[model samples]
Target: MSTFPGTAEFYRQFRPGLPGALPTLLDQIAPAASPRRLLDIGTGPGLVVEALLERFDDIVALDSDASMVAVAESALRTPLPHGSRLQLHHGRAEEFTPSAGWQPHLVTFCRVFHWLDQSAVLARLGEYVAPEGVVAVFSDRSLWTAGNPWQRAVRDVVQDFLGTQRRAGNRTFESPGPPHTQVLRDSPFSEVTETVIPVRRTWSADDVIGYLYSTSFAAPYLFGGRRANFEAAVKTVLAHFTTNGVLLENNAFTVLTAHRPSRHGKR
Candidate 1:
């Protein structure tokens, strides 16, 4: 089954953007000369694409889901930088091959790397990365996933509606094999490091409902005929936690970077 079937609309509307420190962090971890190229694997709704366009003149955004590609195309309708270009492809990361004469200085997988075979995907990337290029994997836990009081309350409501464990399109969700850092250490991209940035946001009950629908584990489509009931219950629970109709979400975003050693044996 598709990871996010029928959830593109909700994802585009509610998915969080990268943290403000991301640009600076990328510069430090994956510095490149002018006319840089980027490949964004699993580029849902073009959030990463939009964020990096100013720094990269050429970008290739790939996703296995057609609906996500369509929404990303729509979101990128605004004028890009003078010479910037974005090419969207509907394909899996393992199957993607960069066009002839195109070498990416940086390849990024945000929030979707857990869905891929880490070893295979990193191995395939060796063929596309330019010298000294880096591969960055990023993700931020959702409020419901954290064990805070309000977050736990929200998770309880979801569990009561669905179940204790998560589900994805008729399949029980399975934990990813190994930590990404460990996987990167074992892969060809052995030079691995990570950065964490704290982020906070205020969310309304309505915002929480939208965010819930955007996630694969709790998408509205997963509930089928009971979607409405699930949404109502979530809103009712969130309302209890809301102060002035807003709930505070304090979360941390992490970026793990991997690359081959440089001439001096440094990352």
Candidate 2:
């Protein structure tokens, strides 16, 4: 289910970019230094990878989806900064291993940590990160589930077309488990802190439709022959809330950062 074989293009075109404050926050957490490296798991489209290159000289961007990796490669074709290198890997987080002599200073899982075995991944990070490095997990609610009348209307339309229940690639969408704080508290890398960034975005009706397709819950393949009908219905619902053909959303991005316990310090 991680590989959005059909939604890759939509994902590349419509997925939200990381907040503008992200790089500065990252710099504060792990300052730029020579030989610095980052391991970005679930690096959809390489958005974070592209941003971190300005700070880290070496990066390993890994994703479970080949299509996503391909998109990342295409988007990052521009020459990298001098002394910087990026290596892209197509694999799951549990399976990735850095080359010998390569240890990451920062490990990032943006919106993808929930899909992983949280404790196991944190345990592996203890073996991979440099001293005082961090493991950052970030996420925000999807537009369909946001607390807005227009968003509710859109969600209703999606349910009408698909079903009352949410879907993820052919399976029922189960609610994700405990908050990351709880998960992190029980993991090896347990010194956790969080930052919340308020976000407001305006999207055109068409943009909203495109964004819906980019998600597993509303992917076009789920609609089969009804895809056009679904899109039209979504547009009608969105039009009712649009002023000047744009829908506005107020959302927040939360970053949960877990510090890798110092080797000499007691856990």
Candidate 3:
């Protein structure tokens, strides 16, 4: 069974895109050599690939989920820049092997790093990354854990219907251990730095419902026969906190970057 069945359309409609400044930031930081290449792992709906389409001569986007891969492939089929190529793969990161001489200049894991075997994936990536390449991890806090009143209300409703523990696919959700920074430190890409981008999100009641359905924890199938009732509760909660059918959120998008030491072992 697919980990996230029936949520691909909701994901495309509700998931937030990366910051507009992300490409320019990468441009300044990554190697400026011609034919720059990017490998975006866990590329749900191809958000990172779409954003960096202009930045790389070759882009490979992979996800373990077949539904997500299908969505990304359909969305990213637009005409590309001359000489640029896009490849979408439906496989786990550790199982994927780069084509000969296809070392990527940059490898990115956006929001889905925790879903991976951190150490194994990093070790595997080290073999495929160019010497001057960089690895970046991107993530953001979800509304379930945010401090806003509307967010709290939404979380409460979900828990009331589905119990306290979070659900991911068919199993209970478990957080990956030791933190991403510590894992990066133990890898070949030991030099690490962080950047945070503040984001403002506006949502309507229906938009909030769509976003929840897009998540593994609160997907429509998880609600079973009571999906309509659960949505009603969420809409009622949103109605209380939203003004004129709008709810505002202040969230942070965090980027953790790691790379081999520069000349003289400097960062």
> For each candidate, what TM-score against the reference?
0.95, 0.94, 0.96
At residue 161, give the lDDT of candidate 2. Answer: 85
Q: Ten consecutive residues with minimal summed lDDT in candidate 1?
A: 258-267
lDDT tens readout by residue for model 2, 27-70: 67873456888899998888888777788888899999888999
With a 3 Å backbone cut-off (N, CA, C), the pairs that clash in candidate 3 are: none
Find the number of clashing residue pairs for candidate 1.
Answer: 0
Quantify how close model 1 is to the true structure by its C-alpha RMSD in Å. 1.8
Task: List ranges where model 2 is wrong by over 4 Å.
Answer: 1-3, 263-267
Candidate 3: lDDT of 150? 88
Off by over 4 Å in 1: 263-267
Alpha carbon deviation, residue 153, candidate 3 (Å): 0.8
TM-score of 1: 0.95
**Candidate 3 local lDDT, 124-215, one digit each (tens):** 99888988888999888887778888898999999999888987867888977998999999998999988888888899988989999988
Clashing pairs in 1: none
Candidate 1 lDDT over 80-180, as tens digits, reads: 77778889999999888998878887889999998898788988888768778888998999655675578788888888978988876567778888899
Worst 10 residues of 2 by lDDT: 258-267
